[model samples]
Target: MLLEVKDLHASIGGKEILKGLSLTIKAGEVHAIMGPNGSGKSTLAQILAGREGYEVTAGSVRYNGVNLLDLEPEGRAQAGLFLGFQYPVEIPGVNNVYLLKAALNARQKAAGKPEIDAVSFMRLVKEKAALMEMDQSFLSRSVNEGFSGGEKKRNEIFQMAVLEPTLAILDETDSGLDIDALKVVANGVNLQRRDDRSVLLITHYQRLLDYIEPDYVHVLANGKIIHSGDKSLALQLEAEGYDALMAKAAG
Candidate 1:
């Protein structure tokens, strides 16, 4: 298994958000979790990324057969665990290119590799930026500051492209994006697909799945996975909605 989340339970401010959510992702698979608001999808992503403030009351999360929940946030990144945020934050006064270089170096150092020289790193970034249809000017601008919603989401995908994580969790990445921007972000994600990489997408709408088709689809409700099936389940949910899915699961 590339990622194993077994009987995971998490809470925040004394409120339980995840209730024994178990999921396993093998190499080269794309798994998606779809749910309505307050279904604990984002919480699962945050806990996996080692975000603080959430208490892991129970469960074991192993990545590559090693304990993952014990690692720090940066450690998780170095270990190739990536989280694409629903809302990419703005960091004023931080140049995007410089910030990305620092991030890449950190990962490289963790892997016992020498830091990439400026020329080589820039060349790589330019190639990826072109692939994502990002303007060169955005590279010199402050990180996400004054960027439109679509731009921020695109930047998140761009960061994902640069980092090249082993397992990626995209939490509502399709939110707030128009059709054109959504396609761009989806294309960026699609281009990253590989046999050794695994992706977990948490989304509410089925539209995004149309572009980045997942191998499996799971339905999360009230902090638990109520149903699991193939990709066609997303289309079913889109047509019938969560209420019907919940009813089917209830039966």
Candidate 2:
């Protein structure tokens, strides 16, 4: 298994968000999690990303054979875990190239590798940016500064491409994107799929699955995964509505 969550329970401000949730993702598998709002989908992603203030009241999460909860956020990133936030933050005054270099260098240092030289680094940046269809002018701008909703999501996928994480968790990345922008973001994600890479996509709609074609689809409700199936499950959810399935699970 590339990632495992066993009976995971998490709480914020004494309010429990995750209730004995369990999940597993094997290598090369794409798992899409669909749930309505407040289903703890984002909470699960945040816990895996090592976001602070969420208390893990019980259970465990293991990633690449290491105790994931033990590592800090940066440590997790250096270890090849990436989280694409639902809301990408803006960092004024930090150009994209500068930030990318810093992040890449940090990973290199963690792995006892030398920092990439400027020429080689720029070459790499250009290659990845082009892969995501990012314009050159966008690379010099402050990270996510003044970007539209779709552009921010595109930038997130661009970062994912550059980072090449072993496990990439995307939380509601399709929200607020128009069809054209959605296809662009989906294409970037599709290009990143590899036999050694795994993706955990948290989404509300089945449209993204039309492009990414996840190997597994899981339905989350009330902090627990109520059902699990293949890509067909997503279609079923889209057709039958979550009310019926969740009601079935609740029963």
TM-score of 2: 0.99
RMSD of 1: 0.8
Residue 8 in candidate 1 has what lDDT? 90
Clash list (residue pairs), candidate 1 = none
For model 2, residues 1-251, the per-residue Cα lDDT tens digits are 99999999999999999998999999999999999889999999999999999999999999999999999999999999999999999999999889889999999999999998999988888898898889989899999999999999999999999888999999999998999999999999999999999999999999989988999999999889989999999999999999999889878
Per-model lDDT: 0.94, 0.94
- The residue ranges of model 1 lying beyond 4 angstroms of the native Cα positions read none
- lDDT, candidate 1, 193-220, per-residue tens: 9999999999999999999999999999
Candidate 2 least-lDDT 10 residues: 123-132
